[model samples]
Target: MQRSFILLCGLLLALPLRAADPDGKFAVDGVGARSCAEFTSVLDKPEGRTAFANWSQGFLTAYNVFTDDTFDITPWQPQELVLAKMAVFCRANPDVVYINGLSALIRSLIPDRVIRDSPLIAVRHSGKSVFLYRSMLARLRGDLNAAGYDAGAPDAPFADGLIRALRAYQEDQGLVVSGLPDGQTLNALYP
Candidate 1:
């Protein structure tokens, strides 16, 4: 069956192929993806049914935020979204992850919880420090503007802020604050 074929390929490949980001740019391996179409179209293959399933699993693994019980991508299921979702998250509200975490902290102190959960912060820290998120976002935004996105261009919606977004995502994911995804982030983002 296709599942077995995927398993066989996984065993033979030696290296696990990472999935592309939302804009179909950053390849699974973090290389500058040349053809967004090619990367996103992997699942379009005749044998893609299995690949799509695996891709969805890996994508959810990377973030650990997607779950059958939690997400309701009914209008847009995760399986249908694996290719485009990451880029959208990274491009738009690149710092929202951190900012939202900061917001949650301030609310918690007032004995008010603005959001129920934030993957951006460890819950222990969430109730106490807002500075971590703010300073991190500010520094990250600076890096993003200096070298990241193109002031929000539509053609290249991903912009240059991705590195910053990725780093912030990495830091929040509890990996080293190297500001570089490396192995951990890749695995986390595409586990």
Candidate 2:
């Protein structure tokens, strides 16, 4: 299932840019047009979750293709993180369209979008691992420094100092003290 999902993502990346209609509107199909309330109701089922994931992957790929100065709109997030965010948005705004919720999520992520490709680094803690762009690590270091966490030199390797700092920051924010840049940690740091 994971392999197929990865293949689908690769195909999504190659999709051609779509042209807008004469009225400056784009057509939304599939699960995108469903209400947030409907989306929330389906979250517990694997098929429904998979459907939303596929639609979201395609939508984000399209955004990357069409948006200026964007190589990836969500360079730091995993599919699970994105879905979690969507679930939260849908639960809060049950009357809104799912696509609109995705749009709002994208808007919030704009500030962290990767404008260019960068080397990825593996960050692992507590048996969980995530790959993050080096540029994102630099940005994380900067944010931590700004928040008085002192994450060593910006763009430096992820060392003991960085881990300690991350732990401190997470503890201060009442988040899981994972000592790794998890989705919640990144969101809190960036926000």
Candidate 3:
């Protein structure tokens, strides 16, 4: 499964780049064409989960290639987080195709997409490290401040103040108060 996903990503990366066509129609392929109920039903099986994840990755890769000024649609998100989001969407809209849910997810992620390459920073908390783009951190700081969390300077490195603010924000959002800018935290903050 991992090998297939890697191969898909490689192939996607090698494709000729193109700009997004807002009105252009595209076909839904693979597990993406399945109904949301079918997608949700497959979540319990490992093979099913992997198939959906790979399809989602492939879609996102194509999105990166086609979308203007976008490198990654969800740079800070993990595979599990993406799947979780899909599950939520599927649960809410069981009659829709999985591709529709993916499209909606991509639309929600537009504001948080990485516009260009940026330095990847390893942020450590509780002996765990999460790699995040520098621009993501800056944007996160701005979001925190806008929400009255006051995460110090927007461009500053992760510090005690930022940790405190993240904790406060996480607590307020009813998320895990780990004081780390984890996938879920970032999703909640950005969303």
TM-score of each: 0.21, 0.83, 0.82
lDDT of 3 by residue, 17-106 (tens): 544356776667799999999999989999999999999999999899777899899888888889998999999999999998998999
- What C-alpha lDDT values do all the predictions have? 0.37, 0.89, 0.89
RMSD of 2: 6.8
Select the stronger candidate by lDDT from 1 and 2: 2
Clashes of 1: 12
Model 1: lowest-lDDT 10 consecutive positions: 122-131
**Candidate 3: lDDT of 157?**
98
Candidate 3 TM-score versus the reference: 0.82
| Local accuracy of candidate 2 as per-residue lDDT tens digits, 114-169 | 99988889988778777899999888888888889889999789877788999999
In terms of lDDT, the best-performing candidate is 2
Candidate 3 wrongly placed segments (more than 4 Å): 1-25
The regions of model 2 sitting more than 4 angstroms off are 1-18, 125-128
Q: In candidate 3, which residue pairs get closer than 3 Å at backbone N, Cα or C atoms, i.e. clash? A: none
Candidate 2, residue 100: lDDT: 92
Cα lDDT for residue 33, candidate 3: 93
> How high is the lDDT of residue 88 in model 1?
36
